[model samples]
Target: MLPVVNNLTLKNYSHLANSDEVSFDVVIPSLPGFGFSSPTPKNWTIDDTARVFNTLMQEVLGYDTYAVHGSDWGAFIGWSLYNSYPKSVRATHMALFPELPLQPEQLEAENITLSKEDAFSEQLWVDNSVGGSAYAVQQRTKPNTIGLALYDNPVGQLAWIAEKYISWSDPRRGTGPSVLNDHEILRVVSLYYLTQSFISAAYIYNQNPSSFAIPLSKAKTDAPFLFSNFKYDTFFIPEQIIRPLTNLVYYKSWDFGGHFCGLDNPPALVQGLREIKKYWHY
Candidate 1:
């Protein structure tokens, strides 16, 4: 079973969705403020999101033990879920792991390929930090100001997110606007629009009140994990960072594709899921 943003539905794992090969039921619930689920009364944090999911799993789903797989924002949710109920979650697979301090070897590796452009790009975020922090400055600090402006205006939102999706996927590459298919990107974003979570989603920037906010911690999960990296991704995490964190069940380094592998390269995404199912059965 999987929890998903409202509006965007989960199609069963391609080949295995309806096949007799895998009998386990796959459930994808709409998250609060995104789909059928109700919007949260207050700005929600990753911890708060995890708590709701835990309740849904234990009380509604009636599952005492299960596996978890998360990608994008879902990756953080899965981590929080695993931490909150270690005994219940048997294994977890996160496609994008969170930020973490570089090991000595990692720093050495990062230093080896510091091209002029890379250095300039790295320097831009050096002061504020990477990924979430930069995003927080915009979303947490000035949400309403931005949200009021973007609401109902779809084109603005599309371009705003599209650039990041394209840039972060691999800005260096001459990839067009987005790697993911147009439809999939809209499907994911529509959840926010339909549920009026646009402001709420932005609000998550401010309410980062939880242990999960940190990059590294002693709070570890016994569940195994897997990561698939497309070499062109804007944010490349060295194997060194991932290998130490979990039971790395699988790692595939593809020569092509970007951050949105599922959209950019559907066949590859399908194959990846197939491989995971095989591993799950094995």
Candidate 2:
């Protein structure tokens, strides 16, 4: 399945794009293979997507400098843009910055003391690693196998993706209306199946195995970076932990959003993105 996390960003957060206060033009790519965008070559990595995206901005669109934002695997691709072409990419904002969560054993090995909320996030990481990531494993190893299986079976595809939307999001369904309701989930699945991009979307995992195991050493950057941490999100490594390793200029947290920050809390997402303008020269 595709990173529904990115799908949420594509569908929601119109406040940033539509706001009169935000003066910049918004260009959101369908990201290689999520919906209408064609799937990349089997060997293509996230960096390839970044390279083409940069070309689209600087050459095709005739923009000298720009800012970027993303979540989920989109964050990985966004990181590639900032790391490889920081001069062109003036600033970076991410709902989910590319921070690899320490495994339970590694956490114990480090013997780090964290705040209660941060510790809870670390525990969530441990739990998700064991149970919430089987789909990722299957997709990473056998995209085609499952892709073919679900290509024509729209119901199967919908079910496969809906589970992720339900679980990864913040836990607040019974109390009130969910930010992403049934209609939203159905919308994403329908788009995937209708475009026949269901199979190709899964290839992102198989093609970019490096995303899941990204080394902290690669987090270094000279360009301004903003991270919006949603406390209820799947895996959150605290700012204090990540600040020393990178050029993390801004870090904010909220209890509202989850993996789908754009959908869960668009205002917060918009605010974080706008905050990057302070550092961006253009």
Candidate 3:
């Protein structure tokens, strides 16, 4: 779910603003059925959540327009919000671009040689697809099975989530152990166990299995689009491939950090957001 919880609160934005006169009204909602929002309704997909979020901004918060940013499932929901309400969502920034890998036919059609960075990124994707996606496959296809197995078993839940926290982080953060300490891992695992949300959280994969599929017609948005790809993230979408999927306002690549950039490199994440803010017209 959410990144290191402390990193997302409004206080973090104060540091992000620095000397700028920028002020933010941050609204971080728990995804339906995760954390405090339990009992995720049947058929609640990313699109459904996106609609609800839009309503929250427009109606509840009384903001006519707002910018959106996300990573992981939040990235999917952010795109859905932009796509569904382009006028309301003024700009969009994401740390992860969720497009699926290009098909062989598509790659052949381009016939462009990959840069060294692109090549390495591609190899990483291939490796993860082959070896590291078993958990994802299970979540997508049989969430209930694993959910039931882990629901009451705190140790099992801890092991399952902690593995990702270890493996998905930048290896440089550790010499012999993971950057995430046992306490941090236990905090998240405890939240899941206490809330009884571990089961429903996995259902997100089942609800949006085709989330990575890029729209055939380009899925262009009027909102200014930006993304930052940190080196150790699970996948990378090259600039050439990403351009058609977004409005393509800004793009940056970081040599450090990983999937959980908010935790692994909070200042860098904040800096990227600040950069995106420069292009925010609304």
Better of 1 and 3 by TM-score: 3
Minimum summed lDDT over a 10-residue window in model 3 is located at 1-10
Candidate that beats the other on lDDT, 1 or 2, i.e. the better one = 2
Candidate lDDT scores, in order, read: 0.58, 0.78, 0.77
Badly placed stretches (over 4 Å) of model 1 are 1-24, 100-106, 109-136, 170-179, 186-189, 209-213, 270-282
lDDT of 1 by residue, 137-233 (tens): 7776787887778877777677656666665453433343333555655766675566666766666556653433466553366655667666455
Name every residue pair that clashes in candidate 2: none
Per-residue lDDT of candidate 2, residues 87-142 (tens digit): 88888988876768876566667666677777777777777878898898899998
Question: All candidates' TM-scores?
Answer: 0.72, 0.87, 0.87
Model 3 gets an lDDT of 0.77
Candidate 1: the clashing residue pairs are 6-34, 6-35
lDDT, ranked from best to worst: 2, 3, 1
lDDT of 3 by residue, 213-238 (tens): 64534554678888887777767677
